[model samples]
Target: MTGKTVVITGASSGIGRQAATELADRGARIAVVGRHRARAEAVAAEVGGVAFIADFDRLDDVRTLADDLLFACDRIDVLANNAGGLVPTRTLTVDGHERTFQSNHLAPFLLTQLLLPRLIESGARVISTASVANRWARLRLDDLNWAQRPWLGGWGAYGTSKLETILFTEELARRTAGTGVSAYSFHPGFVATSFGHGSPLMALIALMSGGRYGISVEAGAVPLIELASTLDPGFPSGTYFDTLTGNGRRHRLAGDADLAAALWQRSAELVGCVPAR
Candidate 1:
């Protein structure tokens, strides 16, 4: 992977940070992206790469980041849509969309869409960090933003966003079937990362587990690294993985084909982009 470029969002912390380090250690040119400029730069410095600062809450920022990344990197071999988090409160972004929905799903969707051409040209691979929370997702497709009920909590919203991640991966793989680029989403497992510290349930788990059950950030990043670097012919597309295993033990509604397609269409409409044929 020497000289190959890989762009990782949310690289300032958690699994994304570990993935960036591992990839860079393996000789891949890394583009570390984060909302905080200093933290992003720190991570990039550690990885011998460049830092990109972008606020995922703003679509314009995401667009500009994509353009800048393409301009800076001659070729992108991997794109990891890892910049996401759970918002404790139901807030609206500047785009008038739910914060969690926009940050965890829409922003990555837009970034991936805008960079698809460059990825195709470079024969790159796309990997997104989904979660086991997708199983708890009671997605109201008709009211995705909770604009009607408006009583949705943080955990539900986070789950819904992860469901969207899985769906987007499936549909993207279908759209780019014959193309060299392949997209896959996966659950990094229950790592003791700073992913859901704001939630009571997450806090409870952290308390109860006493840090035993929870895995390390390095372990959580293994599946993503494998998906990005592996040349295994048997690696399946439009599938969800858990810790590098292909077992369906943790499969959920996130892997539903029909829902994946619908989510793809909805995402395309949201981003104002046509799905690849």
Candidate 2:
């Protein structure tokens, strides 16, 4: 990993933060991204890397962050779209999209699209963090913005967004099929982190799950690190992985290629980016 330039969003805490530290320790150049400038800078300082502050709540900030990151690095060897959380309330972003959906799905979708040229040029890999919760999601594609009927709670919204993440990864991999760059989504396992801090219900669930179900952040990051640095050029793309347990562990719904393709089309429309042919 020495000398490789890697960009990670949500690096201020959780699995992203742990991955940044581990990768930087291996001599990789890190770009730490977070909503809070101070926290982002602190992580950057700890890893001897650069800091980028941008709130995922706004679409314009997503574009600005992409541009700034491109300006900072000659090439991005790896991009971990790890900045995301579940908002229990039905809040609308400045762009008028539901907060949870926009943050967890659209933000990464747009960022990845904007950075595709650079990723292609540098032969970079893209890794997105999804969750096992995708299985329970009942996707309402017709009312994705939640204007027709508001989300009942935050957990449902979060699960829907994660399902979209898996779909996006599948379609993105198909589009980049023959290219050196690959796209993958994975469940980091349940980790003890601040991921649930935004919602009390989530925090309670995390607390109750306790240390047994929740692994260390470092342990959760193992698959991410492997996906980033693996030398296997022939590794499969568009696959969902779960901590070495193989395919069966993933939600059956997550593997629906038809739904995945539709979600990809919708995401491209939402982000205003043309999907790579």
Candidate 3:
């Protein structure tokens, strides 16, 4: 990782933080991105990397972040779309998208598209944080904001958003094929981290587990760290890793190429960007 440039969102805490620290230790130059200025700056300083702040809930912030990153890095070897969580209730962003869908899927989708040229030129790897809850998703691209569906305390929306993440990653791989820019999504497993803030069930699990639920934050981050490094074992691009391996259970809809393509187009339309063919 020596001399490589990696941009990690949500680097202020949890899996993103652990991954950033480990990558920096491996000699990669890190871009620590977070919603909190203090925490982001602290983590950046600790990891010997730069900090970029943006709230994914706002599209304007995402735009600014993209511009800042474009001006800051000459080459981006890795872009970690790891900033997001399950919202406990239905909420809309300033841009009029569902909170979870916007933060977890739309925001990263826009940022990645904006950075596409640089990423393609740098041959960067795009690694995203997803979850096994995607198996529970019954996504309707037309109802992405859940306006027509019952919110059901928002877990369903979160799952739908993750399903969107995996679809986006796969479609991204297909569009950018042979460009040397790989894309991947992974479930970090159930880890004890600050990521439980938005979901009640997750909060209960975290409290009960006392940081021993399934794995430590550091252990949960291994897949990301490993994939972002030059030492990566070379898993196929667009592979949705269950934890550390490419083989994992997924909803039948996840592999629907047409749906993935349609979702990509719809996402691009929603974010006001041209869809990649």
Whole-model lDDT values for every prediction:
0.84, 0.84, 0.90
TM-score of 3: 0.95
Q: Which prediction has more favorable TM-score, 2 or 3?
A: 3
Model 1, range 1-277, lDDT digits (tens) per residue?
7888999999999988999999998999899999999999999999999999999999899999989997998889999999998887788999888888899999999999889889889988899888888877768778778677654458888887888888888888887888888888888888877876577777777789785667888889888888878865256676777667663343367567888778777877876767543
Using TM-score as the measure, what is the rank order of every candidate, best first? 3, 1, 2
Best by TM-score: 3
Candidate 3 Cα misplacement greater than 4 A, ranges: 206-212, 230-232, 275-277
Q: What is the C-alpha lDDT profile of model 2 across 1-277, one tens digit per residue?
A: 9989999999998888899998998889999999999999999999999999989999999999999999999999999998898776788999989998899999999999999989999888899988888876768789787677656667777878888888888888888888778888888888877776657766677668763457898899887777777765244787777754445255567778888888878878877778544
Model 1 CA deviation exceeding 4 Å by range: 149-152, 209-213, 247-252, 274-277
Worst ten-residue run, lDDT, model 3?
A: 227-236
**Total clashes, candidate 2?**
0
The RMSD of every model to the true structure, in order and in angstroms, is 2.2, 2.3, 1.6
Return the TM-score for each candidate structure.
Answer: 0.92, 0.92, 0.95
Ten-residue region with minimum lDDT total, candidate 1: 246-255
